[model samples]
Target: MPETLLVLLAGLAAGALNAVGGGGTFVALPALVAAGQSPVTANASSTIALVPGAVAGAWVYRRELAPVGPASTKSLTAVSVLGGGLGAALVLALPSESFDAAVPWLLAFATVLFAFGGRLSGALRGTLDRPLAPGPRTVLVMQFVLAVYGGYFGGGVGIMMLAVWSVGLGIDSATGNPMRIAQLAAIYVSATALFLAISDARSSPLVLTTMVAGAVAGGFGGAHLARRLPARLLRAVVLSTAVTMTVLYFLRG
Candidate 1:
């Protein structure tokens, strides 16, 4: 009962974080692994289950979705689906040992990325007289690579995308957020497709269902809460949770 409740709460928090900011994977992945799923399976399971939540966030921003630059929304979404599929395939092909070894470093990198993403964005904007957008081709290439990462580990991929847009084109985070949510949903769609088709993630039907239920609620409520709460406060709360969880995982290692 305790573990069940924890995973449910983790899903809620993770979904809320994904809605308001990003870094929900940091919560979802670790919580599942702690609940006794293998690293790879946990990742696969979490991706499969939380996909609907990503879609929900994307739906809320559907009308307001912004493009990265010269790259149209259709083009970016296409690349996301392709790259995410490739990433999901990679996870299935790679040995489990490799992911276990890399978990600590991945978590550390994600933690740092989430921590400094905004500062780095601010610095980039400050240094330039006017933020210039990256070429269309460049934006596409960057999105593909980030999509691969998002499909695989997906801890702070949203922050990475925001940074990519911020530096590549001086796009404001607020403006880029809807795009981030949309692209993320595309990636999750493909990744989840692969997980359900080939992975053992479905074996734990109870865990998957519970988390999915909680995530749906969180995603819906979070979308509404985002308008009411200050962005900084929401981010701080999510970041704090991510940092603490990352530290715990590293210490356990």
Candidate 2:
């Protein structure tokens, strides 16, 4: 019962995070793992449960959905679906040990990226005299890779997307957020489809159902709340949750 409650709370918080900024996966994945799931299965199940939250949040911003850089909405969505499915397939193909050992490292890497991604991406483009925004093709390629990563483990995909848009395309994070949510939904939809067919995502029905319910509520509520909250406050809440979760995972490792 206690474990069930924890999963519910995690899902609610994760859904809110995804709606407001990004970092829901960081919260959901760890809680599911702690509820006696294997790392791989927890990752898979978390993806499955969070799909509705992503969709709900995306729907709230439907009217505001816009293209990133030179890429059109349809094109970006296509790449996201394809890359996400491919990443999900890779998870089923690889051995669980590979994921277990890599989990800490992955979390740590995501933590660093979320913490300093803006500066890091800026530094990379710092040498360019023109500092041009990424073109359509460039945006597509980057979206595909990030989608693949999202399908694989998610974690900080939202933050990563914001960084890419903020730095590579000179788009403000606020403007890019709606697109981020939409892309995340696309990735999760594809990944969840794969998980439903081939993974143990449905093995734990109670956990799955509760998390989904919580996520739905949180996602809808958070979307409405996002309008009132400042962007910096939203990012700070996400970053704080992300940093704390990453540290705990490393300590466990």
What is every candidate's alpha-carbon RMSD to the true fold? Answer: 2.9, 2.3
TM-score of each: 0.85, 0.89
Q: Give the TM-score of candidate 2.
A: 0.89
For 1-253, candidate 1 gives per-residue lDDT tens digits of: 7778878998898777787777778778878988889888999988876787788888887888877799999999999999898889988988756665665676666567666765665676678755555778988999999899888777667766765675567665566777887888899899999999999998888888888987878876776676565656755654675576567667867
Give residue 170's lDDT in candidate 1 (0 to 100).
61
Clashes of each: 1, 0
Candidate with top lDDT is: 2
Looking at model 1, the pairs that clash are 133-169
lDDT, model 1? 0.78
Give residue 57's lDDT in candidate 1 (0 to 100): 81
Global Cα lDDT for candidate 2: 0.82
Compare the candidates by TM-score and give the number of the best one: 2
Write the residue-wise lDDT of candidate 2 on 147-231 in tens digits: 9888887877777787667667766556777888889899999999999999887889999998898888888788778757677
In model 2, the clashing pairs are none
